[model samples]
Target: MISDLFAKIRRAFGDYAVDKRLLQEAEISKLPGFVAEYLMTEFSMNYPSDWLERLRDFVKRHYFEASEKEYVKHMLVERRKIAIIDELRIWVDLEAGEHRGIIPTIGEVDVRVPADLARKYQMAMITGMWGLIELEYSPDTAKRGPNGELLENPVVVVGFKPFQAPTSDPEILRDARQYFTLDEWLDVLLNTVGYNHSAYQTVEKKLAVLSRLLPIVEENTHLAEFGPKATGKTFIFRNVSRYTRIIVGGMISPAALFYNLRTGIPGEVAVRDAVVFDEISKVRFPNPDEIVAKLKDFMESGQYERGKQRVTSGCSIVMLGNVEVEEREGAYVPVEDFTYILPKPMRDSALIDRIHGVIPGWVLPKIRQARYHLSQGFGIALDYFSEAMHTMRKESLVGEMSKHIEVAGNITIRDERAIKKMMSAFIKILFPNLYFDNRELEIVAEFVVEMRQRVRDWLHKLSPGEFPKDTISVTVRS
Candidate 1:
């Protein structure tokens, strides 16, 4: 029955020409419906097959073609040129003492780029920046590798856009928001994150909203969410945006994350929109104090120094870990000291204070077979929605709070800042184009305050004397 419902939903959205079977073949069907559709739309030619290998063979065979037009015509007919339209993430080959874009599939290819784009492309390669480029494949250096070894294939960059948060127009934003009612918009947003709106209750839907939106809506947003395993905490950062990198369990270094002074290279934080630390409880850092200090500074100020270079970035940091929740009466509640599950260094009061939101992941129900979305409702295509939120990040929605709401006077500046940032992000996510009544604003603001307060409560629990009680509250001033 569920499979039949999913097929019907797929057919309804077939006007977009998405390859639904390709998703199942690629084993990426668990991703959000919109996300799967977006991927298919972009790389439809490659669907249900390893098209990269096919592209490599085409480039190799056509290397000696006399007529460019004839070769391109062949590509057009064969669906080969479509590869150039979809952006691919490739590494710049520095091992050869010359710059070359190395497609993992077409190994050791001589990468060619236009003269005008050389500088920017080179810088991106050196800085560990994700280069989303449309390649012009070539077999020019098929005879020799960069190290004078045998190289069978080479490629060129015909067009490119450095992987960064894309922006959307205000008019488009206004027009898009106008199409959906409040509940419908929420449903769309939830489904965008792979939640079936009809499958969950009202509260779960709301939790899904905050979970999906919190990371995408702003820079320097610090979030920590710990739940039972397989709760899909890593999905958005992993699958939603091209401008995100998820670092799984490892001993992460300040040099790797921020900047490497010896090599004069900027790190992940310098480029990606959101950097998630997955299984953070198990992640070990060599210099805990240095990481904690630098992270604290960066989370607050959005800047960090390595040796002589003071690099700045707007990357949001997300920490995802697994936790064991205990049942209190009938409901599942987080253990009394939730902070104890985190690494000892991360439990610092000052460090905890910097976190904008600490999600109550335990409140979320464990995923079952039926939890997946099979909804008939429409949602923004993943790429468009991601770009819209990226654009919305630049706007100052925090100012809207002053006109309609206020935080308690007892709240510290940091607390207020966290609340305002979280609330503003919620507004951008839930009500883009800044369209919402005072009542709606108040309700969202309260949820934002509560999330922030959870961090505050944890801080006080960890250090009783240093942190104060929960006198702070969010109120609608008008």
Candidate 2:
């Protein structure tokens, strides 16, 4: 039965369907899933029988480890030119009157890029782009400081081949969703994210796992998920989308999150679709008052002003943290207030209140290799899947809520908007055709309400005076 379903998925998606096992077999786990899959598909189509060997060779040659930075630079200086596949970011040096590229693997930040190339791929200047970049070493092109000291590297970007989807059309994903039942669609989502659907036993569990994607598919959505470690919270964010920037445990400066006052460059929140704060409890804000103040404004209104720049972005904020969980009556439950898991700067009631939803991450099972946690069946290519979700952000299905659902009880305006945004995201992912009946709408409404209610519950626990116990009720219109 499962094989048949996999066959159907392959037939439906055609070239967009990639066998997830290929990624492991090729030993490209270090690369993002989208980039790995894109290389696999491209090589397989171009080199049939020896595609695996060719793909391995391609990765070995082009992809460089941080340790190989000196070697790569040596090759560039000796050979005068070298091509490498890496996440390339471009930033203009106004003082020098040149475009600079940051190739992370090679640890070269001052590599020069042609103005035309920068103009062509502007996103690289913003959030960076993964691509095959050819660099040439030209000693004459090197800049000199006023004191005649060498000011920058001589490496110049000569060519680029971006590793992105050929086209991004959400309608393709939407049209495809209609062919599968809700259960099958859920499995498809799981498989697409490199999970084995059969390993997950229940629909609720599957939905719990899928809730991690809410911030990705929705605009200006703020979410928090805390549970025991190893729940694959960071894995999905890292591998699933290039548009998401994950900041591990460290001090988060206002410059990094919003805008760099010195560089005149927008930060992660302005460039990426979602900014995930992994291990939130350990993350520090250098200027707590300043950073938290700006964060609250951005989370609430999607607008932030740093220095002379006032920027508006639809980027969502997701906080992931580990918490103490106890098994009570055969169910894992959080023993402490969820807010306690956040860093001190983020524990403000006003900041917490701005969060739209809280995912009960304890419900998800730990990912393990022996338990068949990885997908073996066919799934959509990550590059394609990421693009589809990014494109979906431009669409708003919130109007559907007012058309079909009604809120009851003492729900705050924030709670209502949160519920509506979440439900709309669910509808966009599950029922893009907007053809669901009242029963389906009610189920989705209830699920999203529970998500928002979790936020309200946390608020009540944190500041009972400010946020009293309130019931958020929703019903599908008859």
Candidate 3:
């Protein structure tokens, strides 16, 4: 049954496209061998274009053609931008047997062959076309055997540690034996994505609004996670889906994201799934003016026009990065700046008001666990359900807190959409059984209010001594 199921899935996702079966036909070769060759022969063809006349269109397409491990930097000129980049050599270590723990190590492998090939690798990185892996070698010459000759076996023996996939908890499945509900599934998902409810005050703070982010991601656009490093901000976007895409850090520019029309038009990556902004605070461009403008329109209206093409892109934009922290448990970001101050173009109040909810990463404690074990019976295929829930969320996603809890009369919502998102997110977090009374509702509302307030106050702190005079205005008076 499992073999049949695997075959069905293979057909569904088109895993055969990469041609691993042919390698397996011999001796079941390791995945990296094929991945490497695929990158070298197939991906290495893309490169830094000629400055002589027209910019080559094929350069940008090289990104998607390359395998994972490449990073892109934006190169914009005359409204025609091309992402130029270098590949990342990813190294990960894992506990062999159960594979419950994933040790992600960052580094690179450099293969130098004169000056021209180096430029080719750089172009691959800039455009998000291919992954640059960790390599350490000198191109000067290969090793020689005893007789002044290049060794027959020239391959260097390098031991590498790869990424570890956490084992599904046996206990969580055990717990699922007790109930058939979405909450149980959420518990598993929360665990799979490395969210430990015990460590962070975030879960406690927003117990009121926990369930909003559940459901599957059915969209084809993009997902970006930009935040301060190590907040687990990127974890959710990265680990959640098999089909969901993730862009880490380095060079994120207009051309890498959208299109550079100097030659033929190249497509942006996030046009399908979510676009996560990692270390978003570090997203700096030579000229912030254009990048800033694009962010604002996209965040608010989801409209991005590159060159002569105007595309109504659909994707969730999640920006997370580390904020400079001075205090122990202060918010990493600011509230007033949540939407508006994120990027300069995002600074417009009208645009800022539309943000669903700025998640407070500062309040979220750092992640520390060898491996995450989800609650029993939690559904592993959460992305699919999340997509289904998104449709349901359109109408059913309203906050039902008022029915059970009374607002303090002080809490006011300038953005009705935000209020709805808070309420819905709360439901999603608390899902399985969302039926709640006024007491439960009140607790949830406090979380909702605190979450936004926490974001706002943190933003205030970023400004020198610009703390709010009466910041804690919306007290969750149950």
lDDT of each: 0.63, 0.86, 0.38
TM-score of each: 0.76, 0.96, 0.48
Give the higher-TM-score candidate: 1 or 3: 1
**Residue-by-residue lDDT tens digits, candidate 3, 1-478:** 3233233333432311222222222121222222322332232234324321111232233323233332321212122222222222211112211111111111222222223333333323222222322232322255466877853222211222122112222232333223423333333334323343334334342332132242223222112222344555655454443223345545566775766554223344333345666655455565566666776667666687877877665555555555544354544543233333254444444333334445554544554442332111112333232233334433444445334433343233543334445565555445435544455555555556555554444434544344342333223233
Report the Cα lDDT for residue 285, model 2: 82
Angstrom error of the Cα, residue 355, model 1: value is 0.4
Task: Write down the RMSD of candidate 1 (Cα, Å).
Answer: 7.9
In model 2, where do residues sit more than 4 Å from their true spots? Answer: 145-147
Winner of 2 and 3 under TM-score: 2
lDDT value for model 1 = 0.63
Best-performing candidate as measured by lDDT: 2
- List pairs with backbone clashes in candidate 2: none
Higher-lDDT candidate among 2 and 3?
2
lDDT of 2 by residue, 159-181 (tens): 99999989888777877877888
lDDT of 2 at 205: 76
* TM-score, prediction 1: 0.76
